[model samples]
Target: MISAASEVFSHAGKHSQDEIALILQKHLKVDSAGHLSNERRISPTRNQWKYETFSPVWGAPEGLNSKFAPPIDDLKSIRGVRGIPHQSLRSVAQWINSKIIPRCHMEWIVSSGALWIVQLDLEWEETDQGKDPADATMVAEGLRPISTASKIFKAFTPGDRTSWPKLKNLEDFDFGTTRSGPRLYFATAEQLQQALATSGPLLETEIDELTAGRAVLRTDLDRTDSGILNLPRTDTVDGRLAVAWLRDTLPLLSERFGSLSGLAVILHAFLPARAAAWAYFDPGTPIAYVDALWGLPDGLQVLPHDSFQVDIRRGRVISQKIRFKPRFLCEAPDGTWRYTEVLRLKGRSQVLSHEEAIEIGLRTASIAEKLGQDAQIMWFVGIPNAYGVDANLPWYRAREKAQQAPRSARRYRPVPVSKQDDLATLPQGDVMIRLDPEAPLIRDDAFLDEVIRIAQARKLPVELQGSLLSHTYYRLSNGGVPVVLAEPYSKYFRTRGRRVFGKLVRDRVPVGIKAGGEHVSEARLASDDALPGLFAKLVEEGQELLQSSDKDSQVEELSDLLEVVRGLAFQAGAEWEKVNQAADRKRETRGGFQERRVLLETSLPKPQADAQLDPREIKLHEFLRVEETGSFASVPIAALVSKQGYASANFELDGQPLVLTLRLSGSRIELRLEEEPSDETNQGDLFSAA
Candidate 1:
């Protein structure tokens, strides 16, 4: 619905939220007799339904029950039946905004049934998301729903922390053999002090009685063991995301953090997936409204469940039910509704820990394995949008410090569109932009990283094709075969081919080409140098590498050797199977070098005539300084000198016997054959005695 709306509005030129609201009303709401009136829905361009079968549970009056019943006569009388689709509406509005709005100067939120545009052209503000919505001007004026105008239902904002969804049933967790990992948390000093100040005396005393660093966390539920003892986990999502977004970041932070003064206090919290699902979605009378409001990614929905079963022995959960179950039931890989867990950590001191995160990752991986799908971490509908790195903030600065080079670090120049032909002319490889032209995303970075990772893993040669500033294109190829940049092949390196997406995500950042964006991942590189010679050199190096004690080193080097040989063979017009067959035939007849036998010397009778000499031998010796001192079967002295330059002869120096190698010092002076070529390694045997 949002996509079709965006296409329609964008094509029509400049539009206002008010205009969108009208169009939405026509499309979203049914007519008096429950019929769609939106023309766009039926248009060939969209071809989508504007309305769905009305449900009786929406408290439809008797007059509106039957299919033939008169269209809703009084839109006002049914006004009281409407309420919270809060998050879903926000999600849809955000989607439309992303797809249509180019300028981010204004922020729009759906409230009081009207699109409230908040001007944010100036600077970032300290947003209090939990503030009461009744204070908003639009809500007080009774904007859209008749109930709000008549003061029947209080308008609530989607993320109002106070209005979080309630899960009533609590089941005991049977953590058979599973022990809960460390309970991670995050909070700033101010938030911690505020919580303490608001705590009741008994609860306060309980917290006070705990050891110096411990605290009692109690839920507002009528159950035993609700107050679990936990130490203040002084970690923040800002800290986690800032200091450990990538695996390499932790190593950089662990030992060599240079200056602390540059640190900007980061303000952000992480609610683990289990807890966040509820805050991002609301289950209301009208179910479709939830989808539009949350704009959740496809193949997923939210539900909540118990983290533990009824049996808890000591501290170890001994049963399969010991795992944390979110109250929100999301659609798993197998199309089953399963409880998905999430946690939220906020502020400076309290944050989710690295170990707990690993635990969560493992749990999800196990779930994915059971479902016969790639292991993935599922997220709540709109949660991804809520968390983002603001470069103008301290976290961004920390990010720069953590990285070996900042994201903006220059690597190569961008090939202009005029150089579109240049992409085709690249030495040898496909052309793909390093990343999107706009903001660079971690997921994209991960995607490219995976490219390199797979190539290295497979020992395939990969070249960073070229770059447009920070955006670098990559080409992964082997035997002149480029990667297909699609599924089966595209997902070769990813642990999970799927992704955890944000509400507005289109299949989660769409992992393929953009329209009109030309992409190539393989190329048969052209070179002026002798590729066969290079291949030979690489083979030698690889053989040397094989001499190493480490089998892994040999394997990697051999992979490199194979890549070079493939290119060389292809360039030289050689077939792999034929080469292999030739090798097998030779090995069978002449035998291989399996036995460590040393060839101390090899000898053959010298040929007495040129006719007895092999052409291969002459070609081999053609590279030497020749002094034809002895008569070559009665050749003229002048002619022999002119042709041979110099010749060699056997002689005795003192008691030692030796052949006076063709030394042109005194006999004759001439240049050596410098451009001769030979692939065969032995020519001395070829020349001697035929």
Candidate 2:
């Protein structure tokens, strides 16, 4: 009924809240006193009525009961009874606001063919979640539900201290052998200080908006014996200790990050045992690179971990490599965790399966998609479950650091290709196997098996056209001949082939002159007189790198360009240290180009000119004079030579040795040929005199 009212009067000022309530009351058969009228009842023949019926059928005479049944007024009244729908939620919310009860979890029921308010509780009843933070009191008085971890936190914190709000729920608060991980909470500086009154061995790390999360801290409070000692304990690491660490570390971090306002103090309940994973994602690509280790991710700073590449778009594991496993972190018998040598498993046993890695990649990709930026995610693979500890939007470092130069063409482990004769015996149809062409494909039985499974599930012929990114599709013909069809193969082949050749050329230059430092060096470039020319070449390469669409070419070109810049810096008698300092000063004031902001045109008031001038009357300086005979510059070449720091230079004019000398004539310098009597000069000494 409220939906009907909204649809009837959607425009602003067309109807007031009172008008809507009155309309609802009339339709729902409510009295002026807000009590439901005694004109509603469940139909006696409700069993015979259609179980599921639309609005139109509900209003019909016989639709409420059996078809042959006589019509009843109360039956029709049921159709007018009101309840919340998508469109009516807004109207109901407005009505709820006017109620004397400020906060409630309400229930509405259709009774005697009229809608009736059956229940109204002052607090959320859990039948369904009410509004987030149902009332202001929830925030002002800390009335919100406290998870087990948070309750433990409150016990340690002072009663008069600030309340540490729970950022998220601790999925499991009991420290059990099967526990996956701890719950995370957030606190302010005051709350953290209160919790830090009692502290012990704790792990500390700094965090800001741009950081990629930190390791979970393990403290004495997280010990299993704490529960027996009647002390507050958490299944995960003690949040109090984590908060204390943040309080002490925050000031130090502020020096580097420049501010504490943006810092979010997070406390994680420590989950013991098992392994951890971290993933890096780029918005431009459909892939996420993941690294996993046998121990806590805290060791990621120093230890080598297993790497896997996942195709986020298709949730497929594109490539994976298992590295040597020397040790892993696990729960010690004393309820603390430490690293131990990998005695149980020899070689590199996979920390996470292909499925687990793909799931992490997909989740990371979803976060990046929603945020519209790149992201890094960290997770813990614990007993029977994987916990996502943190997600972060990594700081933008495109201009802050130089990209690693592309070294060599990517080498892929060759996969067995089907021969034409083998293809001729296969089914004939179309099958799509989402694959990354550049990904290593050797010994991946899962990939090939999956393809075959998909084909068999689709019941396609043996000869089928397998499709993927820029690939050659094949199908068997009736005559047992294999027919091949490439969908835009040339496009990818030409581009990739050209990039390989380009990289070879780009790599060759830097490697050849890199040795002996003689071919290109500060000393060589100092007197070589080609610094400006090399600088110009750097500028050209920079422009090409920026404008080109090929990513491989850009990397190669940028590396070569940076080499030239280093040489130019050396020739200028300035080390990279000075250059970096100057760059920092300029960047601090002028800013970098990462914003991609373009200045189209500025709107400013036109300046008032004192006078106007005409081009015809203005006398221009005669830099050069030409009367269809020859040209003569007002400035002497000898002056230019001296200004250019050259005393004398040898040049070839019309294939003749011309030695030009810089001589002082009055206040100006003039260029004069060395006194040489030769008739080959055409005009002899006259030419030299002129």
Candidate 3:
């Protein structure tokens, strides 16, 4: 199973700033003025260790060691856990003390039963990557280390994990941004002095633009103010420009918007990543899709790329396709980002592992569910972690259909060509061009046209011999001709060919010569309940052809594959034209198979509705209500709704209420009753009894 650690921290970054603030409020006791409480705490420092541990802090002696508690043995075991063993605490302290620069921050949980380290912050004062694993102490002490403080709280608290993005007010401010104003004003004179010190000579463009506009100075507005500050040119460094702009606009903004003290200044550090993924949920089809690229996801939507489809609710990938990626965007050494040619990746290459894709898909689904609408997110995967940089709803919508959709009538016509070409008027006489399997199979229209010209010069009828697809394209580009195949085709192929090809299959007869011929009409109307089975067989054969090294076998397989398709369409009483139109519509909406996607697995969720309950759920529901009595009889029907393969019911037994959870354990229904007062009633016994 893919760990939710990456998703949790990534979401916490930008999308769930409110949750980040809450985590700080609950654990770090960060107050208004960005002050940490005197309370001892362990804080995560945004540092990572070996892609496994999210953040590992040093000093736990001041935060937790002196106290006694049970040790955490599993990562997930942190749930409902209140403490750690005294030795585990000491080991954490030892690790922190071993560091030369013991810059540490710690916090203690009051609500949790024991001294629980919610967060950890460490300053090792070393650049060596080998010194990163201060967390190895906790592991060495037989205690399970945690990823983030939020992960611990999520497991112990009864609330949904933070998933989506939401904008909030200053009270919940974990991060902030700066907005410009019309005129300059500083809270203090020192700020103005600082701005002036950073100013540089203006550029020609700035001077020209300034000369073209009105010139007003601070001294003009107020005699007490200093003479007009010559702001740096816009062409200068952004910092100088920003400082100059703020110096000019702050006062004007304050005049219009009132007090500016409430305004917060944010200094954000860029978390650079070489690769990114753009993931979204289409609620209409209710599937999750992710498009990944080398650098940032900027402009990824408009680019041809690889993608993966996931079953939203079940968190399983339904299909994945890796196309020929000729170029990838990445950051340059000087800090410029651009697309660069990567010849090695030009061929079909999997950019992300299966585990990474699953995590991304599940996280996308979680976000969409939280938003209660279709949404998308941009994620950056810098080694050891992924970051959620941005998220928003799509700006485009599907094309609207007509109120009264037009009906397409099937019509047959000769392939249109320019009248000036005498070759177009040439008589197509009886001459079959046998395509040798060993020869180069060039499908270029120009090459095929040249071949046709030679045949026309010979004044012989042209009967094509190739795969059905090639023949179909040829007829569509040129004109109709009989497609000749060697005799002794499989019975199934012959029957399908007769229905699909019409008179084109008759001995020496060209296609499109007769409409609704006897063979075609008879084959269509004939009872072929087995057409569906034949289609499945052909599909399986096509897959085998993909694996076979023999090109002839592959060509042969593809040759008759279309015959089964057309036969199935005919069997359904639809014209080939109508089927093609339907296929076009599907391609526009769901996309095409040009990338050659493969369905790796199907982990679809079991049905949960009353009308479509899984058999185990039905049996459990029945057993709880019918086969069992007393507490089970009074259980709420809604409580039996299964989630994550388990359901819990709260009911009173012997005048005391307890929660009995039921989950499928192999072939049996296992029961775990919590808050039971009797020591004799073991959860194992209850499972056995069930």
Highest TM-score against the true fold, candidate: 2
TM-score of every model versus the real structure? 0.19, 0.27, 0.25
Decoy 1 TM-score against native:
0.19
**By lDDT, is 1 or 3 better?**
3
TM-score of 2: 0.27
The Cα error of candidate 2 at residue 194, in Å, is 4.4
Q: Over 4 Å off in model 2, which ranges?
A: 1-182, 194-265, 334-337, 383-690
Tens-place lDDT per residue, model 1, 423-527, is 234332223222211111211333445544543444333222111011222112222323221111122222212223221111222344223222223323346
**Candidate 3 residue-wise lDDT, 1-690, digit = tens:** 135655666777866556442232344321111111111112222111111111121111222332223434433322332333334444334444444244454443323333345555554434223211111111111111212121101121112232211111111111113311111111222333343455323321232232222211221112113221111112112233434554666565456436443332221112344446766664544456776655444424222345676666556776665554445544443323344554421224566666677777776666566556665555554332222222221211111111211111111111222222434454354333432211111322343455456544553333322222122223323433233332112333323223252211322243343432323242332365456555554555555455557889878777766776776776678899988999999999999977544333356566782432222214333343423465543443323332233555566758777876765542234567676533433544555565
Query: What is the lDDT, from 0 to 100, of the residue 303 in candidate 1?
Result: 13
Overall lDDT per candidate, in order of appearance: 0.27, 0.39, 0.38
Q: How does candidate 2 score on lDDT?
A: 0.39
In model 1, the Cα lDDT at residue 183 comes to: 20
User: Candidate 1, residue 316: CA error in Å?
Assistant: 26
Name the regions of candidate 3 deviating beyond 4 angstroms.
1-267, 284-286, 299-302, 345-347, 383-690
Q: What number of backbone clashes does candidate 3 have, counting pairs of residues 3 or more apart or in separate chains?
A: 22
